[model samples]
Target chain A: MPLWDALSNAMRMTRKRRIGPDQAERLLATGHDPAHPELDRLLAAATAPPRPHELAGLDAALAAFEEAGRTRRPAPARQRWRVLRPLAAAAATAAVLVGGVAVAAEIGYLPGTDRPAAHEQLGSRAAPPSTAESGHGTASAPAGTVEPTHSLPVTPGGTAIERLCRGWDDRRHKGRPMKPDDLRELAAAAGGEDRIAAFCAPRLRPPGNGQAPPNSPPSATHPSPTLADDGDDDDQGEDGDEQAAARNKKKKKEDE
Target chain B: MDDEELAGALADAVRGDSAAFASLWRAQQPALLRYLRVIVGESAEDVASETWLQTARALRGFTGTPTGFRVWLFTIARNRAIDERRKARRRPEEPRDLTERELPGSHPDVANEVIQRSETDWALSVIATLPKDQAEAVTLRVVAGLDVAQTAQVLGKRPGAVRIAAMRGLRRLAEHDEVRARRAESMPPIDLQSPRTEGV
Candidate 1:
């Protein structure tokens, strides 16, 4: 039994050591071994030429290939459009937001331009007392413009004088009677009610004579003469007035 | 196919040229079918067809050399074969007897073709008798003509393990009873230096 076990162990070791990676590579590559012709035959049989049944599915495979090509050809372009759609929408939204803020700032609708609200209120009061008392067209204009004045120091004296001049000119042109409240404010500003026309004569000249028309309504572009003279009252207000004046000058040049 | 021919065909195929794709199919289908025969048995043709369809769908996105393409192709076939086996296991139908399987022949020289086909079938049947890893390693290395590293990539095994499996598989084929009987018949009757004398 001991001798038989030794023989079997030796045989197993020899079998294990005989075939390795290098020998397998050689046998697979050349297949011309004189010592192992059976292995050569086995390899030859395994790698025989293609049988007829192997290529039978060519038509089906090609059809599938053509189908895949047809379906996938337009995918990249559609994918690109899909990826860019959101970016385009975001760009358009950003443009609208920026443009809206700029228009609001130009029209004195934004915060920190509290002087426009004060002027707007005085202009409402300076309308003909019958129109102002009735609470019609000019009364509603300053309602949206009144919220910002509470945060600012009151400076309605100059704006009131400009509004009275505009109201007096408008009444004279329309051949309408003057409102008593407006006449009282004009009397105070001109030192008397009879001198109201003289006080407004130089102030109401048509634009382009270094004096804008007082017949024109009080808007962001037309700062009251007293406000321009008393510039130290509000620095931001003066800057806004100057910018509006510069823009108007440029617009006038373009129009000419 | 050679590298240059394969590169050109792959480029044109990616551009949706049917003729170039057909060339690629012709070059790869034989080895793919033989490998599938070893792995999936009678369903080799079906699995190969599925593999080609999948390859066609993903061909545009595949970027690699010819060798890499071969590796990718075999990887797809292996995955499909695994799926087929899983499906077969779930169904659990009666296994087909190997002796009853028919060998197809379309050539005019009928007798010679039958003999050769039977030999090929016999060899493949013997290989199929090996353990799964050994059988796959041998089929990929010898029949599909892939290098050890490429076979490892397809089989998802280490190169050393694939090499060892292939070596053992070949050794087992060499030591099979039928192979030894055939070797004895082909040898001179009075030979004394036979290696079998020591082991047997």
Candidate 2:
């Protein structure tokens, strides 16, 4: 048995242990263990009442509480609106303005506007022959001359100029003499004068019947959009170009 | 204050009586500071301040006796201490003073200073030498005057675990060389005096 237990038993026999829970707590806090003087010193030292300076934080803590109480409701609500208001406005503007223009362009309502006219001006500067003969070829064909037809089945959005270039390239491939006029038109159909090589190199490949590709800008300058819808028309246009070139070839052979 | 008076003050505080709230703070803050000192060292004061500010904000929604209030306040203090420790680790700033670096665990050598400051500071330093969980268990048990059940609630540990930790911590303190030497010089631990100690 420990010495403290022997001593505690002696005390219990002599006097009643009437200490309440609070007294027991006080004894523990004060480090009053009979068997351990070192623990007593340590606990008493550790649990001593804090001095005045230690409680200095009370005022500051209370002030912080008061400040938080004052700002709790209004600050976060106002801040939320401050952040979200501009974002909402910007989203609305993008949805209404940019989306409207794109929608108008898709339905062809924009072609009659100054944007397409500006594009035509740039196209004319790229190749001057097209500008000179533009009204004659676009309006009506001269006697025995092939008329430039906008009704010719093409990838939608392909201009009459691009189709004419494609037709001319087809004919040249079938043993017909390549025309200087046709070369000039190809340059105009390309967006810039420097782009003629890049533009014609891909589109002039002989079409596989009804295999019109998606309108990828670099894979061919021609807008081969709407393959399923325009496949039959593309086949018909290819056949017509081939037949025209075959006739021209036969005529040249006979003349020789 | 008795339990009735404490419950009255708490009710008044919940109703926005700052004076009543201050009374509660005065009663509880000392023990809270001691507990935080063991866990957070020199930053205990700052953490205690944060804890009170949070307690003040949430007091209206708080529904319990003064004992419950202590548990809640200490819980907040422990969480704030954890956050401070995490922030300190991420920053790794140079210590502002050599004393703070040497504090909490290292026993001060100046005999006069140790005697004078033993009231709270020296005791905290000794307790801080214990393992983190043991230190927390001892401080929450002895300093905060929480029962085993309440200390377990604050530490999120089982009652038996808290009791074991506190017992181990006390045993370790008893076994310390400094404490054992002091025990040799001092009189026996039993006090035959009446149980009318101040602040009990």
Candidate 3:
């Protein structure tokens, strides 16, 4: 048994020594090893070109790619919404302010003080007489009579004009017809059928412009206009008229 | 694909282009599969599929050069292979000897048949016989074409350790009886004075 152990130990000592780490690193990096050609053959075999079955999963992989692409497509849109949300919130606030002013004008709360001054400004501009006449007629009437006659027409008349402007814009873009009653009310407010376009042009221009017709009292143009609209129009004037129009529409809905 | 083409494809793939991503898969899949084969044995294909799926899912957000992309892909594959191995250890299925695995059936195309029966299979089987650390170090460094630093990163080892493991693995393969036999069969008798011939 001791002789057998000695022979095994001798065999172990004669076995090949391990290659240097640097040499192994070089072999792996460059795939060349003159000292060990067998290792070269082994690496060459290990890195053989893919078999047909190896790529059998390509179709499934690609399907996963497409599904991922589909899921990722919405990320940009979400990012866009991240940017647009604040602007939408501000616009919504402006809409509420505009709606409040429209309602104030309808209730005669604003027209009592602001409408006379607006009429005076329009009177100097030599605006449509029907609008100036109505304002002068209401201001000249007794205060007791003013609330009953003045408030009634101003309420429905203000709403009718706003409705007509929205309907007109929609009709131009969508080919929808206006309600006949709204058209007649708008005609009466303008004092002539032909003057409706001339009357609506300034009103449709975004609120707080001070150019709205005298009959609507231009409450958005009032010196003490709703603070939010005043602030938003100042801040967002460069955002363009389309956004302002949308804000105005939103205000009208909120007021209603 | 060349680096220039790979860069272009990577950019396009990040923008959700399937064709560009396909080119990437075709280029990297072979190396990835072979590396996984050495790391995970019979579960290599399943692990590879999981790797590609994960790569596809993250492709849109991935930003890197071609080399970095390859590293990222291999890192993901290695992590998934580790997970598979952990699960395999828990379940402990029946062990089938490597030689007992089914051989490729006969094919009509001679070249295809030869390829199926090539030394690659034998070499891979031999590599799979290595100790786990040495096999992984060799496979990542040689089969996956990673540098020592990269192999160390994949194996969570220091670069020095990886180099040693790889060296030891190569030395073991060099002394393998089958490897020596094949070398003898391929070459004519040489001078006995050669250092490698001293033992014999």
Candidate 4:
């Protein structure tokens, strides 16, 4: 059942050992091989007890987990690579893009792109941008508009088609085409209005402060524009020059 | 190593010193391997590896002398041996080859004439039929070099149990030997390979 009673002494060595004079002679006989002592010695060694040297796997497993922690932090480039790669790039890009997407899917958006997306994000004050979007050209969400680099309160959208369909319109309470000045104000408020078209490819929402879109510089931090008083800007092209001047000043500072 | 030395080595190892760990392993492996051979029987090498794996995991906590190390190491080994036994116990038992058919000495070490002269073959055939626990106990005590207490610790039993088990095991072996001796007397002892004496 064990191996054979010949090994009984071997077993007994680890348990209770009692070898009579005659019994000892027999074990000697059974272990008649030249290496019996060596083999027995080794077995004796094994039976002595396990020490720290024997527990390699558990130590290795713990070390491996620690090493893994070092390699797991998400990088910003990895995030963009994930989304842009699959949607706009090749299969290799897709693989990289997918990784970031998986990561971003849970954490909200990619890091650098976070600010712009938040700026374009509507009434959801939960979005964190404007403060974060300064020099960034990209918005995390496809919907918001890019503001002039100098201004703030930029509206955002994914595409012109999508943009036109967003928000309740004044005429029919349904979505309608946005005015040119509205785009200008958004350009100024967001920062670098020239990039508005590229940004418009994604659907975007209007700035919360009732400005002329991303085209104007912010006169105030908070958008306290009551809808009745602020809608007047929707009817005019008068604020265009003022915003353009502000954008020119921003460009000059950038060039310096 | 002595307790202080072993503890110092363990301290070094826990501090991420590979050399300390290596020294510990080297110092402990020989004895550990010997015990494993008796416990795992034929799969000594494999069980030795498992034992090392276990030791590696717990090495950080070790702070004992070489003697204490042996006890600690054997404690783990004894548990493993029991586990192996449990596994084997679950399997269907193989029918034993108990028939008294002694083959002529065929090992290269034995001369053809001495092989013909000795009772080696008959002895081997009979011993091969012994039960596993008895065989293991006999092998470790006779061959592995563990004292009664250490052996008991390795087998995860009281020293008394180890003594009893060893006693019974060796007694049975004596019975087998007597049976073989009678058989040998009837057949005549040929001059085979000289019987090898087991180590003390």
Q: Name the regions of candidate 2 deviating beyond 4 angstroms.
A: A1-30, A71-256, B93-116, B185-200
lDDT of 1 by residue, A143-235 (tens): 554422222322355454566777887897788978987776565454344445655554454322355544675663233333344332232
- How closely does chain A match the true chain A in each prediction, as TM-score? 0.27, 0.20, 0.28, 0.17
User: Candidate 3 chain A, which ten residues in sequence have the lowest lDDT sum?
Assistant: A148-157
Residue-level lDDT of model 2, residues A1-256, one tens digit each, is 6998898777645423343344334444555654343467677666665545456677876775565455444344335434654564454355455555445433423332322333233222323333336555555555775543332233222334445545554654575754666554443444322234345443433232233332222323332332233222232222232243333334322110
In the range B51-83, model 2's lDDT, one tens digit per residue, is 787778777657897778767777777766765
- Per residue, candidate 4 scores C-alpha lDDT tens digits across B96-179 of 332222233454645553433222323333333456445545544653445666565555455565555655654565445455
TM-score of 4: 0.33
Model 2 achieves a DockQ score of: 0.13
Better of 1 and 3 by TM-score: 1
Identify the candidate with maximal DockQ: 3
For candidate 1, write residues B105-154 as lDDT tens digits.
56787787676667667777888888888898888887777877888777
Model-by-model lDDT, in order?
Answer: 0.65, 0.57, 0.61, 0.42
Worst 10 residues of 4 chain B by lDDT: B191-200
Question: Which residue segments of model 1 deviate by more than 4 Å?
Answer: A1-17, A32-35, A76-256, B97-106, B187-200
At residue B104, give the lDDT of candidate 1: 50
Please give the distance, in angstroms, between residue A226's alpha carbon in candidate 2 and its true position after superposition. Answer: 50
Sort order, lDDT high to low: 1, 3, 2, 4
TM-score of chain B, candidates 1 onward in order: 0.87, 0.81, 0.82, 0.54
Model 3 agreement with the true structure over A1-256: per-residue lDDT tens digits: 9999897566545547456776787777755565556566666667666666556788989999998776554355335434655564565456455565445433423322322233233322322233435666647545554232221212223433555665665564566666776665454444333444545554454443455433344332222223245332132211222243344334422110
User: What is the Å distance of residue B168 in model 4 from its true position?
Assistant: 3.4
Give the Å error, residue B92, model 3: 4.1
